[model samples]
Target: MKQATRLMALAALMIGASTAAGCGTSAPVDATGLRRVVGTDLIGARGATAADQRKIDRTAVGLCAGGVWSKDECERHGEGAR
Candidate 1:
């Protein structure tokens, strides 16, 4: 009876650990937020001139395109092409 109880406790502990491990694996992607951060990092705090801003936008689009962002979204931002 004690051995059975110990086995049950071990099974419960394994289940709990598996559930906790799965919890950290499923975060949603924030594409718009990512783009904004990338743009700001590329541009600068004071901001850029029209030409510079265009360049920054293109670079941001390219960066996002290489990752999870869809082709349509990347094109909308003007970074669609390789």
Candidate 2:
């Protein structure tokens, strides 16, 4: 009975931690999904080259145009080169 109670407590703690992790300000774009869409490893980070940045911007604008993402979200995700 004691072991069962401990297991239950551990399960509850794990659930709470996972829930909390999803509650914060998360990235607008899923990196893996974006990579798939862009077909490149370049993430348009602060250090990205101009060409890479342009590619990222084009993808973001396409996402926005297609209603896959909002303008604000695109901007927040650092893909808004406009």
Candidate 3:
């Protein structure tokens, strides 16, 4: 009975160690990868609201006006991919 308990404990520890080794934190997402217009803007770090379309539009215009990211990069990634 003691030996069986010890084996079970050892198995549990191995399983936990293996799982930890395989686990990883996911990378942050890029907004331009979004497929829908709904994702065009955001609010308070979440996402855009339909009621705030005009506000979002203005924000988008301001952002797009500067053209921070080069058009060449956008074309390389097939456009709208950030």
Candidate 4:
């Protein structure tokens, strides 16, 4: 009975560790998705010239891909971009 309890505890510990590790990893960024977001934002704004739009796109990409924003924020914007 003691050995069975020990085995169960060990299994539980392994499962917990794996779950924690998975939570720490994030999904890869979708570049096209992010670009679409920047495009949408630029379109929604009034009086943004082509030059201004280009600049905004560059800045958005930098922010999302340069590790300035969290993965969740990037993903949120990516979804919006689409």
Q: Candidate 1: give the clashing pairs.
A: none
* Residue-level error in angstroms, candidate 2, position 47: 6.3
Question: Which rank order by TM-score, best down to worst?
Answer: 2, 1, 4, 3
lDDT of the candidates, in the order given: 0.45, 0.47, 0.38, 0.46
Pick out the ten consecutive residues of candidate 2 with the lowest summed lDDT. Answer: 38-47
Of candidate 3, the 10-residue stretch with the lowest lDDT total is 33-42
The sequence of per-residue lDDT tens digits that candidate 1 reaches over residues 1-82 is: 4323323433454356445545666764544544453343343312234554455455445455546345774565453223
Error of 1 at 47 (Å): 5.2
TM-score for each of the candidates: 0.32, 0.36, 0.30, 0.31
lDDT score for candidate 4 against the true structure: 0.46
Q: What TM-score does model 3 achieve against the real structure?
A: 0.30
Give stretches of model 3 more than 4 Å off.
25-82
Arrange candidates by lDDT, highest first: which order?
2, 4, 1, 3
Worst 10 residues of 1 by lDDT: 39-48
Best candidate according to TM-score: 2
For model 2, how does the per-residue alpha-carbon lDDT over 3-33 read when each residue is reduced to its tens digit? 2332343345435644554576773443454
Model 3, span 1-82: residue lDDT tens: 4323323433454356445545668643533322132233333322233344443333344334445324663343233213
Q: List the residue pairs that clash in candidate 4.
A: 36-81, 37-81
The most accurate candidate by lDDT is 2
